[model samples]
Target: MNKVSLLSSSVRQQSLQAVALLVFLVMGLSGAMGPTLIPAIRVVFGLGLSSAMTVQWIPLVVSGLSSLILAQLLHRFGAKAMVLGGLGLMTVGCLQVRLAILAPFGLDARYGLMLLALAVIALGTSVIQVAANLLVVQLGHARTASARLTLAQSFNSLGVLVGVSLGTTFALGAKTTTAPTMALGIGQAFGWSGAINAAVLAAAAMVAAGAWGVSRTSQAGQAPIRAALGSGWALAGAGGIALYVGAEGSIGSILIPFLHQKSVLNLTLEQAGHYLGWFYWGGALAGRLAGTWLLHRGAPAKWLGMAALGAVIASALAALGSGPVAGYAALTIGLFNAIMFPVIFSITVERSAAPSAAVSGLLSTAIAGGAILSALVGWTGEHFGFAVCFLVPMLAYGLIALFAGFGALLPSVDKAPQDSRMTSSVGNLSERT
Candidate 1:
């Protein structure tokens, strides 16, 4: 190719990579919005705490199951198609939820509709998670894949922060009315639902625009799904991912409530929630930004091990200490969690015998741990206390530490030979400089 052509090609590739980051940002926004919307759902439907929790967990379980099945279809459809389809599903799901909230239907009927909408959203998210992770790996060089994934995830954190803030502002700010005919005004209840739907639609439009920019590459020659599933290293990596997500989710889900305890931070619920964002999610964004640089300089496994250790220590301090010390220790866990997903994901993809799609699918399935571990922590908190519940994540972090420390010794699929076609293309692109 000529110099100008080469530069254009390079720009195209970079643009496609930016699309993946945008996808991650959308995923983060939807993920955060789900849990944050629970209280609003409860108010609109007059649901008890346990019933509200059931509504929250349903989507997680669906997402996990969908990921396993979606993995099988990746080779047939390709990443571009899957990503676009996933975004479409999210757009539809959000619209359904929004319409359901605005409908004149009874609360019970609307609740059922909401569940169905969330399930659709979950399925879409699962597909996007699988496709985006694999696509990011393909978009970058193997040596810097971890760094690239982490950097992209930093945008994910930014999305989460924005989603949480918006959800809280629009949904939680809804005012109750004294009107006899309506306990809660329609306008108030639908505010967040409308906002969420609009956001999802906007994201879908972005994904559609970017979809036209990337080539429709196929994975027909990659390793089969069966072989990837059988790989021991892939399984180990999946376990580590599960545990890490479980630990991170459990801690984050409880942070606000834990800090609200009289003996702990003794803050109001809103105050505790605000601090949760700053110390937990905000710390995650900072850590990911820093971790991108750290991963570029050292082995990902070593960094993973160190991060796991930090989580263990932080959880222990949160569990055993009291007052501000406990609160700070609890929030500090987010810092360590920042890189685990990307590092474990990159390591699994690099080492797995399966194609990137199969590995990504399996890894995405492990995210169900968030639902499982969060429930466990909730039970522990009810029976014992929030301090005691910290042990659940602490144990999870301990296992992750072991995995990152020694699990590499296990056998894995040899790295795929570099494709000459891709190399030549990249080389030609670089010549423009």
Candidate 2:
């Protein structure tokens, strides 16, 4: 290739990776929207709080199962197929939810269909996450893979921020209006459902475009699933990922409730809730941006260790202290959490003997810890106190610190030559297409 052709090819490669970032952004948006969607569902369906909570778990359990299944499937089909499949499923799922809500059906019927829609969405999310994580890693230089993924994840945080904002605006802020066909209050809360549908459709379209652009690209070779399952380091990395997600989820889940306590920040429920986006997720966004630079300059494993240690100290301060000190400590943990996932995933994939898809699948499956750990924190908070519940995440973060330290001792794999060959192969394929 000529100099200009080479430069253009590089640009095309990066642009293609941006598609994965967009998918991540949509994933983040969908995730943040779930909590906001629940209350709206409650109002629309006339369900109690306990019943509404089921909406949260359905996606988590489904996504975990989907990741495991798709991981195995990747051995037969390439990442391109998986990405396209995920996007199609998500689009269909979102459409289903929207249509179900609009249908003039009874509450029970609508609720059942809504649950099905969520399951489809979650399954699609799992497939996209597994494929995209591997795709971003394959598209970049092996040395800066962590930084690349972190940068892409920064957009994920941005998506969360935007999703939260939109959900609040359209869902919570929706005004009640009369509908000739339905009950008086039903039409008002349904606005959020419509908004969610529109957003999902837009995201799906973007992903479809991305999928088309990369259709000719090739995925990394698959290693034996048995080898991946048996590797101690991969298992440890998976455990660490689960722990990290659990810790982060536990903290975010309780932040508002904890802040409402008189002994803590004693903020009103509204004020405390607002801090979730401003401090918790905003800090996360900042951390990822900073982490991108840090990972480029320093060792990813060492940085992961230091960030986990920071989280441990912050969790301790939040647990042990009261007033603003505790509140700030609790929120700042998001900053430390920002880079751990990408760093852990990159390091784990590099060190593992299994193929990238297998390692990614194992790591992605570990995200179920969010549900598990959140339940633990809730149980602990109910029995003990919310402040004391910080102990759970503190313990989780401590373990992550140890995992990162151990990971630092392992040998790194150089996949640059393989990546370059893949890139050339992709270029040739693209030209033929």
Candidate 3:
């Protein structure tokens, strides 16, 4: 078949869409569990706020470096093998965390081990996210890729919601912040998640055995990594995506505590977190649903600009408003942020066809922006208070908004159909398992 016909054939399968959606939800469960583990880790390990946040960065650091290597891995192993490998790593990492936490040890020693375990888990998650996202876009519709990402990510938010709630409940009922308590509680949690993930990974592996090359075209054969990295637009889009993720992560990490401290609502940490989840994840879910459709009618840049404007305005108002009103306004920004990451990623992916693999890796690395931006916000919150800390994300959104409005231009690919924007920098492949 011709390249166009081949790619079209790949996109016409409803089963592919079902698998993408299913895997995304499972991935979401794992991803969402990550943030909730943060607070529990802090309480059990007695780590400071900055230190606790650093744990979150481990995934980004590992993922960033790993993403750089994915192009090579894809070339060597193919997308199916690489994805299963990532999933296997994730399962192993989770099991290790569970074992480490359950180990009998001194507080300091246990804390060190916990951090190490978290690092391992982060590495696995990074690979999974990068693989899953690329696969979804590759196997699904092009114009609707961003929307599908948004919809899938909404499940990720739901996973977070469930994890935090469960984590907090288990944490609260646990013993002192001693090593043993941490070990027992966290270990159990990891154990459960690990077992579940292992089952999923095993199933994915079985499916992949039958699914390799299910969607690949002759034109989709390997491209040089250097060529993919050279696309200026892809790199720029990656930067924007990085900044956007950082802003969102920072906000989500700190906003609940900020609201509790400054607002007249006078809620507890758990209460604040729950409300934050509703505002953040709930809005995220809604926005993604809406954004999926919006991308078809308007330019991504325009929609991004609008989302950014909403974030800035809502955040600014939340900063100014007192009592419950201010808190709600601040929470409203989650709605705006809901679609930011997927949209930025989709735009970047759409703009360049020369380096699909490299571009995916580069864009995945942009997640590091979360670590840097969140730290900045935490610092600002310490010195200036929660309201002013938001200024950091506001600036981030503003720049991204500008990019959406004028700085970015989506190029039209001439020959390739499935993803004319494919780049050797990153390969967009579907996960059949």
Candidate 4:
């Protein structure tokens, strides 16, 4: 390529990267509301705690299952179309959610319609995630994508921070005694979500139309799902991502109530919401920024392992301690939770013998962990109480620490044999000097 052409290509790639990051940020914003606005949802629908928690877990199940087909969908539609379509879907889903909340239906009907709307939102989110992950890989080699993805995740955390503030201030801000006011607040929040999605959809479409030829090309010849199924890295990474997503989500989902307990912070709901946004999710944003810097330096596996261990300890403290100690402990887990997903994702992409798109698609399916583990966390909280609910994430984090260690033992790209299929630790260790 000529210098001008190369410069042009570079500029267009940069533009796409920005678009992908925006998608991740909005996805976080939209996703955070479900968990953070549970209080308002209960007030509107007259749900118990466990039932309100379904707003998060059930839709997460839909997203995870929908993601299983991402690679196939991408092969058929390409990244640009998927991104645009996903944004549109999210826009409509948000509107649907608002309408569902406003519907003058009986309790069972209202709950079911809202769940369906959230499922639409989840499906859209699933598509955006797969497309964004793939776009980053296409922009550069998958081997080097860890740091980039981590940087992008920082924006995702930023969105979470914003979402928490908005959900608490708007949705949960209404007086619980006034049903109409509470419903209006929820409607306003959903309106914001729908408007943002629409704006992003327009922006993405404009950029893609004016920019490069990258997303215009098709994913031909290879079946990512098939390739991912055969790869051990994909298998292990899938498990780790599932646990990591679930564990992180589990903690965020419960932070408000956990902090509100008199045994803990003894704070009001509003005060607890601040802690959730600033301390828990805010710590997450800061950690991702720090992790972005650290990942650029090296030793992502070691860093991943260390972070997971930190989360394990923090979660244990949250479960076993009381007063401010447990409050602080629960908050610190967000700090440790920061680097887990991007690091796990980048490592798997770098090491997997499977196609990168296939691996990414496969890993997306593991987001079902959010649904499965969230349900367990809620159930445990209902039956065994907060102590046991916190432990659910503790176990999940522990498994991720082990997964990080396992990845650590694997041969890195520089050290691996020419025969890439020989991935066993023993197989690689025997060949080492």
The Cα local distance difference test for each model comes to 0.70, 0.71, 0.66, 0.78
Off by over 4 Å in 2: 2-8, 36-57, 75-77, 91-115, 170-223, 414-433
Return the clash pairs for model 1, or none. Answer: none
Off by over 4 Å in 1: 39-50, 101-107, 173-217, 221-223, 407-413, 418-433
**Which structure among the candidates has the greatest lDDT?**
4
True lDDT of residue 267, candidate 4: 81
Q: Model 4 TM-score?
A: 0.92
Give the C-alpha miss distance for residue 44 in model 1, angstroms. 4.6
lDDT tens readout by residue for model 4, 25-74: 88887778778877777777787778888987886788778886876777
lDDT score, candidate 3, position 224: 57
Q: Write one digit per residue (lDDT tens) for candidate 3, span 1-433.
A: 5888556545434434444455555555555444555556676677667776765566666667767676556555555666677767767877777766666777678667766766666666666666667766665456666776777677666656555555545542354645456446667766766776787677666555444432334324454556567877777777787778777777777665666674546775557667766777668777877877887777666788889999988777766777877678788888998778887877777677655666677888777666788787767776777778778888888888877864345563432443343222123433222
Worst 10 residues of 2 by lDDT: 177-186
Candidate with top TM-score is 4
The alpha-carbon lDDT assigned to residue 134 of candidate 2 equals: 72
Q: Count the backbone clashes (under 3 Å) in each candidate.
A: 0, 0, 21, 0
Q: Quick one: ranking by lDDT, best first?
A: 4, 2, 1, 3
Q: Please provide TM-scores, in order, for all candidate models, with all chains considered together.
A: 0.86, 0.82, 0.85, 0.92
lDDT computed for candidate 4 = 0.78
Q: What shift in Å separates residue 370 of candidate 1 from its native position after superposition?
A: 3.4
> Under the 3 Å rule for N, CA and C atoms, how many clashes does model 3 have?
21
Measured with C-alpha atoms, the lDDT of residue 135 in candidate 3 is 61
Q: What stretches of model 3 exceed 4 Å from their correct place? A: 1-15, 172-184, 212-223, 262-264, 407-410, 415-433
